[model samples]
Target chain A: MGGHELSVQPDAKLGLHKNWFNKLTSAWASGLGAVTHKELADHLGGKRLLILLGLVAVTGLSAVYVAASTIRESAMEAVETGFVFLLLFSTSGGSLPSFLSFLGFLGPLLGLALGFDSVNGEQTRGTLSRILSQPIHRDSVINGKFLAALCAVSLALVALTLLISGLGIELIGIPPSSEEILRVVCFALLTIVYVAFWLSVSIMFSIVFRQAATSALAGMATWLFFTVFATLLAGLVADAVVPLPSEPTALELMRHQRIEMALSRLSPTTLYYEATSTLLSPHTRALGPISVEQLEGAIPGPLPLSQSLLLIWPDVAGLVAATLLCFAASYVLFMRQEIRAI
Target chain B: MNQGNVVIRTRDLVKRYGSFVAVDRLNLEIYEGETFGLLGPNGAGKTTTILMLLGLTEPSEGSVQVVGLDPTRDPLGVKKVVGYLPDRVGFYEDLTGKENLLYTAALNGIPRKQAEERVNELLERVGLAEVADRKAGGYSRGMLQRLGLADALVKKPRIVILDEPTLGIDPEGVRQMLQFITQLSKEERVTVLLASHLLHQVQQVCDRVGIFVRGKIVALGCVEELSSQLFKDEPYVLEVRAQPTTEELIRNLKGITGVDAVEQAGDTLLLHCMSDARGEVAKVIYQSGTSLLHLAVRGRSLDEIYRRYFLTAEEQTHRRAG
Candidate 1:
């Protein structure tokens, strides 16, 4: 039987003799579209999205309200600054941080919640094998899922930003200038990228851990470590690297500060804070330690929007690169995985 | 079985996981529009073979051709026409059963209008129309299996592979699933490859069965052909039920030329014979002035054939080791 001659029959039903490249391209397109549509519906209609959005909305609105009231009390001083609209995001009042700070703290939680179970949940449900058996490239599953979650998060962030801007305009009685609006749009876009980085990290965790609960915990652990402990750890490392005494000279002090700054930037939370602070405060001229000699001839006015963006370009690029790296890690792991129902 | 063109062929296929050989030197062929069963015990490499056939996993050696296209090279093309129902099939619990089927239809690139109509018709065909609107989470295991069958057929695929479709279902559910598979192949003219560990269940629906043991097929043919081949050197056990059994009757039964031994238990007689001797034994019973109540031959069951092959394979391994 093994040595019997066998004839290969051409598949007439599927018309396989036509241009192979065209067939493959069309198959990939349809598969990706179908997966993206299905995952988008799942994300938008899920209760998880609703709960996370509500948490962000309530906290964000309260922070904005506090900042708005504080700005109104010092309305003349803020108006004189010529960027009262930006003040609504950067101003802090009576024990509450500004809206930008609140977003920086809470945005990762939203990302972690959306992606911590994206891959492992399907495996446990026994749906992974069924979905993969479809006529699609294996990468389409992960790509479509990431794309859908990003869309949902983008929608939530945009809506929240617009709502706060509307409330600020009504309460502070100052419409944002064109530059302020541009800065705010940049802020919104930067926030999305930061959240997307966390989303990719959580997705990577989901792929590495078999259990959904374990993956969720891993994501939260990473978030907590970066958010709370990273800065303190950086400070300890800097002190160890460049010991500073009470009687140290000015040069030594600058050296310690620079080391601390460099170490702290390794954390994504720190990067997000530095980037958003520069974008929101037009009057900000420097992000790092500067000598009196370098500042002697500098003008005492707000920097242009382009200069501010330049000051934070490295931070923005760092966030985008981190997002892509995490996504790429998860993509490689998922593709190599043996997808058996277990 | 239909003598149509061979739709699936594998030559010298093998799979290895580290040092463990999962499938070894497998050679198989399934003609178009035939229901073939890959029967084996658990861990007999049936699922591995099925995965290789579907292009879900690549073989370590040799090659596989499905519908004349190499699975490793053109998996998407093969997948376009081959529908697979995995063991313990799962659905998105949050979605309704109808929605799950529609999702599969969409993935296969069926138009929305056409997919909806086909999904509805399949839901009706699989007896899931009443609960089509309910979330799959609320469905029973049997209902899920039926929904899986409906999902596999949503694209009107030419070949369908079902791995343990009856694994966890109740007796009645298994019977219904077997009936559905048989009807599917007969009515739709679709080729079916069913991988299962349950021998009698596969025997009910499959036209040809390949008894797999230890990553190799020991027998491959129709049921009768396999039975005849395996039992050529073994004697057939003829069980006879009669009233008023006597020594003379036993003596006379053993006197038959093909009968090798005869034993009497209560009102029944067990006769081990080289060939079928039911007619001669009946004539002897009538001659002895005793009434024959029942007669049955017991070596032709698939369960027996599977057990025989398993024992032989185990003995061969032990001999080689020794």
Candidate 2:
């Protein structure tokens, strides 16, 4: 059969008769949609992702359980009971950090893990060049991956948030107010933005590094620096820049603390923590050190949701800017990169 | 320069990385419906040229057009019509062969129904229908090559650019692949741009070949023309073996008009001619006292031509440095 097929002459070559305009049909949406679907499926089904999900679920519910028990025991005012849901996510309980804290600390790692190898893995598999050779524009490949990872993070965030809310209702026997739910949703969105920043950074590393393991390590190193060392480094810089007297005046001490806080906020983890704390805890009025004089003028009441959003708007904007900058850098690098694999 | 038959044209097509120029001012015209081979050694910039042609890599300084569309300006259009098979073809390990094809088809915007039909047909065409449902990771190198070929053809591209398609395949697989490539050009009318360091592989199928050296086209023409060019003033060797003595026959053979020289070695006589002068020499041998037993012509081989051209290129480089 093989010999017979070999003897069979191929028909005359395809003529130059294809409608050139038909070739111009842009499949950007379809291509992006197809790639996103595939990647999302891979992420969701991945064993590593499952393990992370299980860990978050166990840790989150345990904290929620402890916070709910405390809220039930201290339930003296009905009007203020709705605020207990916020405490469930914001305050650490029973020797464990709050669910929001866990997310702020560990969420970026998930994003980084998902995306660190997105581009280079395809290259290593030898599919990056092939997919780029397809009819879709080069932009779609990276955009699809970013969008898919963001979608996965967003899904996990929403599911975890709802689970906490459901547990709060069951454990405390009090449903959260409409405002609390709104804040949780906004917090969920903020967490997605925070995670996406790391995703873009990881993808940039992937494009810069050929090996998947190398990119993953780089991402982990950055995450560790921001999470563990950024604050200590910020304090050192602050103290070195603004030396405190042995018996410092109030103004000097305030200046030293302000510098430390400002420098520490440079880390995405700090930004996310501040933003989520403000969003999840309405009683929290300020992110920086408050002067005693200013506290004397403040009212002993919960601020409105709008006020909380306004307070953390800069942090939200910063997270967005960082995400876009990382994404833009990766976009330019990928576009300018030579297609031939090393 | 936008002639209808000129399917692909590259003028001053140079690609540089830092100080290294991978492709230097290459000018080429590949006509429509012709299987043109870009023949060269490793690092000769054949892959870079192909990348520029596909618009996957921008040329530092040059221009390229494929199917009348500037690949740089209209890469999607060029890519739509041009199928590319990289030297190291890769597929998603977990996806089935058919799934991989379908994914490529989707990216090309082929409707799902049409993509399914086309995928099955290509799978069968590549003799991989039985294993279409198997994961690509389990496939052998030859199977993967065929799968890559099918992937390239999934969109029914007018031009197929194969970069070292037979690079790592077994000898039998190489022969089959070469045959498949020829069939693609002959039967399907797909204009093929097969780039390879293997001179013999391209020589077996290419209608025209461009030999590259140090990022420059050192030679370009059909196989016969290249051979003649390399052996320009050299004579064709014709050996005549006869059972009897040939002193008079050698003199008679020497009298032929185009015969350059004649020498006798025992029962065999060597005739050097500027061109083919076998007919006249045969008639003269019949008239001589000896009967003809065997007559053989030893023409310049492509291997010799390839070696001479590369050596000349090396010498030119050395001379310039000196």
Which candidate tops DockQ?
Answer: 1
TM-score of chain B of each: 0.95, 0.86
iRMSD values, candidates in order: 1.1, 1.2
lDDT by residue (tens digit), candidate 2, A1-342: 999988976444432323333342334454776787778877887776777777778888898887777666667753453487688888676688888878878888778888899999998989998998888888888888998888888898788888888988887776778898899889989988998999999999999999999999999999999999999999999999899989999989899999999998899999999999989888888888778988996778788899999999999999999999999999999887878762
lDDT of 2 by residue, B1-322 (tens): 1133889999998999999889989999998778888888899899889989988888899789889898889998999999999989999998899999999998888989999999999999889999999999999999999999999999899999999999888999999899999999889888899999888888899998888888998998888989878777878888888767546776777789999888877777788888878788778778775688988776465666677788898899899989
Which segments of candidate 1 are over 4 A away from where they belong? A1-28, B244-248, B286-293
Q: Which candidate ranks first by TM-score, i.e. highest?
A: 1
- lDDT by residue for model 1 (A1-342), tens: 544534544477554545576665675576877888898899899999899889888888888899989988887888888889998888888888888888888999989999999999998888888888888788888988888899999999999999999998988888898999999999999999999999999999999999999999999999989999999998998899889898989988898999898988989999999999999998888889988999998888898999999999999998899999999999999988875433
Candidate 2's docking class is medium
Q: Report how closely model 2 matches the true complex, as a DockQ value.
A: 0.55
Reference contacts recovered by each candidate, as fractions? 0.74, 0.90
